[model samples]
Structures are given as C-alpha cells and as structure tokens.
Target: MLGRRATILSFDLDYPALYYPADSGSLAGQRRFVRATRVRLFALFAAALGGAWSWRAGSFDLFGLLGFVAFAIALGAATYLQATDPARSWYEARTASESIKTLTWRYIVGGDPFPLSLPETAAEKLLRARLAAVIDPDKLPAPSPSAPTKQITDRMRSVRASSFEDRRAAYRDGRIEDQRGWYARKAVANERLKQTFTWVAIALELAGFVGAAFKAFGQVDVDLLGVFSAAAAGLAAWTQARSYADNQRAYSRNAYELGLIADELDGVSKADWPRFVDEAENAISTEHTQWRAAKGLGAPRQRNAASAPES
Candidate 1:
C-alpha cells in the first residue's frame, strides 16, 4: 500500500513539480541571454565603426577612446555570460525532470516491475533502483515534498490500486487523450510562433538594408545605419535563440507520434495491459529523449535515462 501510494504521489506531483519550472526556466534563461548578447555585440560593432568613421572624417576627439572602452566592457560582459551559462543549469534540470517523468508514468501505469504478478515489496525495490539510476545523489533542485490532503491522496491513488476498468480508463484519459491534446496544441502554437519570428526577422533585415542604402546615397545620416543594423542583428539573434522552426518541427512530430499511440491504445485488452502500458511509456520516453538530445543537454546521468529498464 505504501509503495503504491509513493508511486501515486510521484506521478501526481513530483514529476510535474520538477518539469514545469525547469522547462520554463531553461527557455527563459537561454532566450534572455541570447538577446542581451546580441545587443551587446551590435553595440560593440556599431561603436567600432562609428569611431573609425569619425577619426577618418577628422571629427576625432574622445569618441575613439570611448568606443574602445565600450568594446572592452562588452567583451568582459560576454566572458561573464559565457562563464555563468544559466541556460546550462536549466537544461541539466530539465533533462533530469523528463527522465523522472518517464519513470513516474511507468510506475503509475504498472508498466513493468509493478505488473499484476509481482510482489509489492519486490516491485518497490525495482522502482527504487530504477529511480536511483536516474536521480542524482545530491538532492539539489529535487521536487519539493508533497503535502496532499486525504481527499487528494484518495483521488490520486495509484492506477494499479484501482479496478481493471478504472485502470484502463485512467490510461486512456490521462495518458492518451490528455497527452494528445497537449502536444497537438503545442505543435500549433510553436508553428505560429515560428512564422511570426521568421517574418519579424525578415522585416528587420529589410529595414537595415534600406537604412544602409539610404546612407550610401547620403539621404540618411550614417548614424542611422548603425541603429538599423543593430536592430536587425538583435532580431536575428532572437530568432536563432528561440529556434522556433526546430521547435515547431519537433512538437509536430511528437504530437503525431503520440496521436498514433493514442489510437492504438483503444484496442488494448485487460490481459495485455502490461505490454500496452509499457509500449505507451516507451513511445513517450523515446520522443522526450530525442528532445533532450536535440537540445544537447549533455550526457545524462542515466544515459538517455536508459528509457529501457535495467532489470
């Protein structure tokens, strides 16, 4: 009973508790850092050119010295940003969180070790070992302990603890339908964002080109060229950092795969529940592991979270 309850809590709260924050944090950190760095690079480039232009035009003065100082400062800031890399920390946590989520789903649905034929204590030991394989020894950024009320606890009792029909319905509703809906929405949203960013980047680049042409013909001040160039460069940086096109593709692919799995799940039999859930969990794990790999989240502690169980 206790082991089952633990599995219940892990699925209901623990996985989410880690995944949500880490996912959001990673995106925000990387986006912000990229944007700032781009702006800094633009400023440094603009100042250097402006300084040279001023010197050659005999408008010399303190401008050249100031530009050099600004360039040095930007270089130092970039170094600091590279050294800190807040995005790396978030990526690491995200990897860990997703790995944990896969394990949680497998446990909740009685995917393997928690099969109907297994003893409760042995099932518990297997789950512990599997979890140990992925979770870091240090508890840093671990999911906060749950504080579920009796009402919540009873409602979230393990699917394994439920009636056969209830278990089937839980799988269909929670794993299949909910996942399909979520991923489908994400795919659409990501595609939309990708289009928007691509257009914005193109528009910004065109504006810069127009500004440069105007400067070349002496219709606009040379200074205006720098401003437009900086804007375009920064926008390009944002576009690259967001990687909207790649995200749209990934989300779309995952949604399609999950949709297929959801369709297959409708015909699963009670006698084949173990294999059905195992395959379902495997599908989920495969997509997420690919996601981590694409992001270069680094070699994970458990090596692709070893989506395949070890014992």
Candidate 2:
C-alpha cells in the first residue's frame, strides 16, 4: 500500500512555486560568480606575464600593449563583479530555495508546526505565511510566467492525509534516505576536488621554485619566476574561494548524522513522530546553517520560533 502511494505521489510536482525561481537564481548567480572570479584571476596572471616579458624585451611596444590589454581585462572583470555582486545573489537565493524546500518537506510529511491534525485550510494558510516569512521579495528574482501557481498540490494533501505508517515510510524513504545519499555523494566529490586542487597548487609552487633556481644560475634570458609565481598565487586564491576542504568535512559530517537519524526513525511511535520529524529537520538545518555560516551569512533564522502557527 505504501509503495503504491509513493509511486503516485511526487515531491517535484508539489514543490512550492517560489522554489523553482529561487533555485534557478541561485544556480545562475553561482555560475556568474565562478566565471568572473576565474576571468579576473586569469587576467591578472596574464598581466604579470606581460609585464615580465616586456621587461625582458627592453620595453618592446608589443609586450607593453599586451600588459595594457591584460590590465584592462582585469579591470572590466572587477567592475562587473562589483556591479552584479553575484555572490550575494547566490547566497540569498540559496537561502530561499533551501527554506522553501525544508518547509515543503515538513508540510508533506505532517511534521511539527504543520501536523495532519490541523484543519486543511488552516494548514495551507500557515504554510503560505511561513513561506512568505522566509522569502525576501527584493532579494530573489521574479517568478517566471509559466511557474506553477499552486503552492500546495493535491499530492501533498494526500501524503499529509495518509496513515501514520504511510507518512512515516514516505518521509523516511523520500526525505531522509534521499538526503543522506546526496550528502554522501557530495562529500566524496568535495574530497576529491580538494585533493586535486591541493596537488595543482603544489605543482605550481614547484614550477615557480624551479624557475627561481634557473634564474639564479643565469640559465634563462626571460624571467619565468615572476610568471610562475603569479600563477601559483592565482591558484591559491581560487582554492580559498572554492572552500573544497570545508565543504568536504561538512558534507561528511551531515551524511553520518543523517544516517543516525534514519536509524532512529523505525522506533518512533505515532505520538512521538512529530517531534522526531522536527529533530530530523533540525539536523538537516544544521548542515545548511554551517553552509550559510561558511558563506558569512550570519546565524540561521529561528524558523520554528518565528514562524510557528498560533494554537
């Protein structure tokens, strides 16, 4: 019975209207920020190389022109970064996306502050209010004209109206297990990325050291040291910006925590289910809180205290 119902019900179809737009905005902003940062780094590296080459060439017009163009590219990238502030957009949009996603899961699973005992009308109203409270209109992009209008879908209502066993099964399988798998995958990916970047940085440093040694022996007419040094510095800056190591640690911790929470789900009674769900949600929220903190977004909002429905 639970398997049949789960097959029919879909979280994607029932997600709130605002979530898609916020998610899109977050992704676009992230891409823009990454592209701009890379462009700036590359431009600076080119400028350093150009300057070094010009010096070695005794102020040749061609090398001077290359340096001028490189500086111009760097300046343009910096100006674009300042004007767009893609990082801020990415963070705020991500906040809205995650908040809506968490609330949607809570509502569908009949979790705390959105229990199945509440009247349907009251529950919908509370969900809407909570959604509004979490989203800042000015920070997020406008919803597309084709975006879904219904915030609470019929599938969501059906899931909420399911028996305790079905609801528990659905939440456990759909939410907890899914999230745990995602976190585990992300942790592995981030760890690989961290190691890759670290090795690349080390290689660049070694190259710079070799260039310096060669320069000291007067074996090369052109100074490769300055160029390699600039490349190393750029790699370091990019690695810091990516925060691969931090994300790897955070994702691994969250994956383990979610595994533990999933283990506790089977023993929860109907009466204790709501509290258990809240606890699980809190664990998930902790990961997001760490994410926001790493991005310098201050503390997570007190969602239960600030947006809980009135008795």
lDDT over C-alpha atoms for residue 55 of model 2: 42
Q: Rate the local accuracy (lDDT) of all candidates.
A: 0.61, 0.82
Query: What C-alpha lDDT, on a 0 to 100 scale, does residue 300 get in candidate 1?
Result: 69
| lDDT score of residue 139 within candidate 1 | 30
TM-score of structure candidate 2: 0.90
lDDT of 2 by residue, 20-106 (tens): 777878888999999999999999998888777744355566766777899999999999999999998998888888888789888
As a whole number from 0 to 100, the lDDT of residue 68 in candidate 1 is 76
Task: Give the number of the best model, judged by lDDT.
Answer: 2
Per-residue C-alpha lDDT of model 1 across residues 1-311, encoded as one tens digit per residue:
11122223123433423344444555566665776576566667656554544443356456666677767767775776788675565566566656656655666566664676676556655655565566553432333355221211233335567777777676677666666676778888878888886788678677778878888898865555566566666666656766777767777777788888777876777778788787777776665666667778645667323343334
Where model 2 places Cα greater than 4 Å from the true spot, the runs are 1-13, 55-60, 300-308
Clashes of 2: 0
TM-score of each: 0.73, 0.90
Model 1 backbone overlap count:
0
